[model samples]
Target: MPPSPRNLDELASALLANGPVKTLPAAPKRIRVRLGGRYVADTTRAVYVWEHAYYPGYYLPLDAFAEGVLSYPGSGGGNGNGDRESGYALATLSAGGVSTDRVIVFTRRGESGSEREDGNVLAGLVRVEFAAVEAWFEEDARIDVHPKDPFKRVDVVFSARPVRVSISGTEVARSEACFHLYETGLPVRFYLPVTAVRADLLRDSAAVTACPYKGEASYYDVVVGGVDGLGEIRLRDVVWYYKNPKIECAAIAGCLCFYNEKVDIELDGKMLERPKALFS
Candidate 1:
């Protein structure tokens, strides 16, 4: 039989993992949303909607939007011809200083069937497309991907277990003061301190990726022993670290976490089973 597809097969799939969605009250804060070069929505009462298989998004009340910025271009008030099943009306958003012609906007008329019971706050609200906006800020810090989900949690705990990492029989790192990051729906990730890793064996890689749950991650290539008679082996972007994690996941800041599928992780003499995940 053909081998099954490995986790982390594609970049898009790795980033867009499946998960449940929920809507909840968000703490009142000054939310300034900008698209192109114009301020689109600025409000202090932003609602958070945690959608399944996607990141948490912000929804602003209709009054929060700037005047003459939102309009329905097509018939039936842009409701897809009175398709109430969707419970949302598609509208075009345009304003002065906006670069794009018309950005897609979803106006919630009522709670969709799929929406959670607590999502009533989303009704009569407007949700802007993240890509359509140049930047979004709660107060001062810019948010990437989407707002952090309040329901999700991330915990970083110190572990004294003997953790070892190897690639093709070459020892890459070994440590006892390793930190383990546990998050919802994802596998437990073991992060080794820089002192515990063989810094000489790792070379800075050019690749960079971002996570909505965590933050921007930098990668490194592992260069060491060869496999199957090959001269020296080089694993591309096998190690990753979040130099500045989001506020919610600040526990893993500047910590290194290896891709379990790319390296052998052994804890206290037992090899760990590589977890199958979106970015395995």
Candidate 2:
């Protein structure tokens, strides 16, 4: 896998190599963000920034942020062209009379020729680290990943094609009632109902990961008999499911999907070649 973009120039190059950036209107939901027991931002108006080859990020208006929370630490220097520049800043969020350094915010100052339909400027916008925050809420329930992009599409379609998953020659799941999830810029993900999977072979795992587009996911370890002189093999956190997916991806709710790179998957009796992606 290629290393992630480290600086403004690399990020710009990556973006140019991929496609154009999109700025879209998001759903009007009350978003309350906190960090280290401090309320960082509370807003009902946030936009989704869909950058090429990257997950959508939330950008709140400057007025939405609490006062005295954002302070400029220093400049992040230029992008080598001398035209584009960036700066680093520290945010101190506070609540209940307690304060903490929430995150290091990065601000960009450049002209990318990208314009929003609403005529709002994208430059010099303050973007917070989604993971650095202690908690994030959409109205009432806490959600994982960043805010789902309203413009991004997620389709979960029922497939009649047979899908099978195996680990070391041991069948783990097979289903005709499989749901195929198609998300933008991602490989096709096959999801099987719990009834079609070998529940006995799956053990709850502590690992949890989030996708800004898919929502929060829980993992399961697959313990199966190994082949080629390897005895019992445990594939840690190989299977995952979203119990409560974001509304846009609700079609895949409660369905299980395995990491294709870590397991053998067959569709319609033909083995699938693992796709090269950010995760691979």
Per-model TM against the reference: 0.71, 0.65
Write down the lDDT that model 2 would get: 0.67
- How does candidate 1 score on lDDT? 0.67
Give residue 225's error in model 2 in angstroms: 2.3
Candidate 2: 10-residue stretch with minimal lDDT: 75-84
Q: Could you give candidate 2's per-residue lDDT for residues 1-280 as a string of tens digits?
A: 1222345444444433443377665558777777667766888776676654355767665556676655443423322112233332344445556554433333333533223323234433445656656778888877676666565577878899999999888899999868899987678999888888899889999998777667789999999985653788898988999999878678788889998888889999899998887667
Q: lDDT of all the models against the reference?
A: 0.67, 0.67
Note each model's CA RMSD in angstroms.
Answer: 7.5, 6.7
**How high is the lDDT of residue 109 in model 2?**
39
Candidate 1 matches the true fold with a TM-score of: 0.71
Q: Candidate 1 — worst ten consecutive residues by lDDT sum?
A: 1-10
Clash number for model 1? 0
State how far residue 237 of model 1 sits from its true place (Å).
2.0
